[model samples]
Every structure is written in structure tokens, then in C-alpha cells.
Target: MKILIVDDEVDILTLFKDVLESVGHEVDIAIDGESGLKKFRNKKYDVIVMDYRMHGKNGIDVAEEMLKMDRNTKIIFASADSSIKEKALEMGAVGFLLKPFDIDQIIKEVEKIEKN
Candidate 1:
């Protein structure tokens, strides 16, 4: 699957890109919500994994806009904050994986998407 990962931290972006690519998925990275939204509009991706606490726009806003553009757009939010899971789903995220999750969890989530 083609996946977009958005995070303010460069290391996290690289890590997710590397991990996802290793699993044979095309991966794209954005440093902020604006860039993420721009890329979202410009590309077709199977999934979007975004950070909830970004400096501008935030993941919720980004996902909300993406949903408006394509309601079927699948989104997964990655954050250390557990409290945002409910909000993330309300904003249209199909999954909420907390930061520091194992690669297996990511794979499982993607598998769940594939099932649907």
C-alpha cells in the first residue's frame, strides 16, 4: 500500500518511511500539517499516518480535510498521547497507534485495513 506519514520530527518521518518501505509499501513523508495536506491532495495513498500534536493545523484538521475530499480515505494517527484516540476516530481516522508502537502493530493495523 502507498502510505503517507506526517510528523514534525525528522527522525520519526525517516523511521516510518524506512520501516514501511522495508515492507514493500511506497512511503511519503511530510514535516507539517500544511505540507501533509498538500501531499494528500496531490497524491493517491492507501493510508495516512500522522502525528496528532503538530505545530500548525494538527492531524485532526488534516484528516478532517482529507475526509471531505475523500470519505473513504483511511487514516491512522500516531501519537504518544492516548487521550486523542477518541478524537482521532471522530476526525475520521481508522486507527490510532500510539508513538513507540512496535512494527508488528503497524503491520497488524495495515492488515486490518486490507481486510475491510
Candidate 2:
């Protein structure tokens, strides 16, 4: 699947990119919400994995913005902040993954989405 990963942390982006790539998924990345939204508008992705807290727009903001363009767009919210899960759900995220998660969990979540 073509995946878009948006996060403020460079290491997180690289880690996810490596893991997803190792599993044979095409991936794109955005360092912040503004850039993420820009890239999002310019391309199409099967799934979007985003961080909840970011420098500019934040994940919830990005998700809400994306929903305006495509309500059915599959989204996964990844964050260190626990409270964002409820907000993510309200914003139409399909799944939520907290930071420091096992790679298998990430893969499982993506697989679950693919199955649906």
C-alpha cells in the first residue's frame, strides 16, 4: 500500500519508513502538518499515519482537514499523548497507535485496515 507518514520527529519518520519499506510498502513523509497537508493534496495514499502533536497543525487538525477532501480516507493516529485517541476517533481516524509500540502491532493495525 502507498502510505503517508507525518511526524515532527525525524527519527520516528525514519524508523516507520524503514519498517514499512522492509514490509514492502511504498511510503511518503511529512515533517509537519502544513507540509503533510500539502503533500497529501498533491498525492494519493491508501493510509496515513500521523503524530498527534506537531509543530504547526497537529495530527487532529490535519485529519480534520483531510476529511474535508475525502471522508473515507484511512487514517492512523500515532502519538505520545494519550488523550488524542478520543479526539482522533471523533476526527475519523481508523486506528490509533501510541509511541514506543512494537513493530508487530503497527503491522497488525495496518493489516487490519487492509482486511477491511
Candidate 3:
């Protein structure tokens, strides 16, 4: 699967990229929403893993925009704030991962989406 991961934290980006790539997925990383949106426009990804909080556009903002571009877009919102899960789901996110999540959890979510 081709996956795009948008997050401000370099560590998180690196970790996810490495893990996903190791599992045979093509992974792309963006440090902020603007860059992420730009990449999303330029390529077709099977899934997008986005951080809910960032300096520029937040995850919800990015997800909303991406969905407008492609209503079927699958977004997995990741954040330390569990409170936003409901809102993320309302906006059509396929999955929500609380920050400090296990890497296996992310893989499981992606696999679940892939199965569907």
C-alpha cells in the first residue's frame, strides 16, 4: 500500500516511515499540513496517517480539505487527544490512533482498511 504520513514531529515521521516501509508499504512523509496537502494532490495514496495537532493546519483541517478533493480518501487521525476521535469520525476518518500508540496498532488499522 502507498501511505502518506503527516506529522510535525521528526521522530514520529521517521519511526512510522521506517516501520511502514519495513512492512512493504511505500511511505511518504510530510512535516506539516501544507506540505502534506501538496503531496496528497501530487500523488495517489491508499491511506493517509495524519497528526491531529500541528503548527499550521491541524489534522481535521487537512482531512476536510483532502476529503473535498476525494471524498473516498481514507484518513487515520493520530493524536494525544482522545477527545477528538468522535469529531474525526464525524469528518469521515477511517480510524483514530491516540498518540503513544504502538506501531502494531497503526499497522493493524491500515490492514483493516486494506481488507475492506
lDDT of 1 by residue, 1-116 (tens): 99999899999899888887888889999999999999999999999988988988888888899899999999989999899899998777999998888877887787788778
C-alpha TM-scores of all predictions? 0.94, 0.96, 0.98
Q: Give the clash count for each candidate.
A: 0, 0, 0
lDDT by residue (tens digit), candidate 2, 6-61:
99999999999999889988999999999999998999889999898899788898
RMSD of each: 1.1, 0.8, 0.6
Give the best candidate by TM-score.
3
How does candidate 2 fare on TM-score? 0.96
Please give the distance, in angstroms, between residue 81's alpha carbon in candidate 1 and its true position after superposition: 1.4
- The TM-score-based order of candidates, best leading, equals 3, 2, 1
lDDT of each: 0.89, 0.90, 0.95
Model 3 lDDT-worst window of ten: 94-103
TM-score of 1: 0.94
Assess candidate 1 and give its lDDT.
0.89
Question: Mind giving the per-residue lDDT tens digits that candidate 3 earns over 24-104?
Answer: 899999999999999999999999999989988999999999999999999999899899999999999999999898889
Better of 1 and 3 by lDDT: 3
